[model samples]
Target: MIEATNTDLNSPKTESQSGLASLDPRSKILLACGFILTLSLLPPGEFLIYGLLLIVLYISASLSDCSPVYLVRRSVIALPFAFAAVTLLFTIPGESLLTLPILGIDISVEGAIRFASIVTRSWISVQAAILLIILTKVADLMWGLQGLHTPAILVSVAGFTYRYLDVLRSEASRLRTARQARSATLSAGRGGGTLLWRARVTGWMVGSLMIRSMERSERIYNAMLARGYTGEVKTLTRFELRSRDYWSMLVAALTAVIIILVAHFL
Candidate 1:
């Protein structure tokens, strides 16, 4: 079952107080985009600039009532993507830092620097996104995208995907519960199943889920049509930027420009 979003964009949630959560979603979106863009422009080996960026992020997080430890913990999602850059250690030509013990291959200094930079950038970017989500509700984020002149179709898709995530999760949970109920226990109190048998059952569950989801989608679509559904998502919540919103966005833009310039020139 899909849950409807009734939260207002202008109203702050109970947990989030009147700081970053009170700011206009449009300004927050623009600030996050500018910050990520500035981060991407920095060249490798700029550890000082990266440190400065982290400081800026920390300050922003504090203003938003977001814990630094929580931010760091959530940012670990970037580590797997960072590992994708591991090939750069052998691909780039530079002075050797050290030779691998098993392969006897040398790791280049330039490659190491680049890898570190990539990891740092990815970590910072993910935190920025997390901060945005923490500050704004999913409905408000979608509304902000519409305010920013983003494509309506894209916005609708993102909004629907987020809205139905709980539905899919509930369906999956029911399937898991049913499986557990039907499964037999072995002598050791573990579920009785060979590896291949478990895999086959998993495959069947996935296929069954796919078919059920399709049928549910059709029913939901018919219900929507009956209720006068439209192609574009319309919301009652509106955003009006105040003086503080303007000032905050201006300050963030200037700060991003200064940081990018400092990285490039000095």
Candidate 2:
């Protein structure tokens, strides 16, 4: 079995020194879930509420020693996925905003508002999750999940997935190195292969990687079984909630409640 590296098991110096990062992972997890849930509950077109929540997110980012620009850049990853909500631009019933020139579809004002809300909600939620990931090490995260009564099997799977992503990445790197060593370049310094040939080679590389990964995984599993890994992730550090943890949770819960209440009442 592969040994966990410090990079995998240990929190970074920045996280260790940050105030918010010092909180128990359980508290962070709960706060993120509550924030996302609150965002989901807000009615469509609650742009003011969304903007306020974004301010809260940025404040948390600053508390954790993360850059607001970096957080925003990472959060933009959700936008492409948010495009799935585009159909809502025509599906929701309301006054027509404009007719599409090509599709001849009339975009409803309500649908546009709903789509914007969905995109904003998704972007904010992803940033919240990214903050959690940035602050906690994988081992600590897994331990926190276990402590929070997350199912053993799911926690185990998550732990393995996080650990082996680096393994898979290393294997891919090796494959790329080997490919480059073998690949020829043309006089113009471009790759020698035609488009189709390059595609075929890429497919072959993928297949080879999959086969090798499967074989290695089988050996790793057998070795793990010999070492008594029974689908339970164990950590040396025990997670106990402190006063700060409770206080943080309380503040987050109250903030979420207030946001929800304001969204509804105001």
lDDT of 2 at 143: 85
What is candidate 1's lDDT per residue for 170-229, written digit by digit as tens?
797788778878998787866678988988998999999999989988998898888899
lDDT of 2 by residue, 1-266 (tens): 12322233232335454767888888878888888899999998999889999998888888788876776766666776877899999999989999999989999999999899989888888988878888877788888888899998898888778878777867876777777789987878677689899889879989999999899889989999999988665678777899999998888888888888888998
Kindly give the stretch of ten consecutive residues in candidate 2 with the minimal lDDT sum. 1-10
Candidate whose TM-score is highest: 1
Off by over 4 Å in 1: 1-14, 180-200, 222-232
lDDT for residue 39 in candidate 2, whole number 0-100: 91
Q: What is the TM-score of each candidate against the true structure?
A: 0.83, 0.80
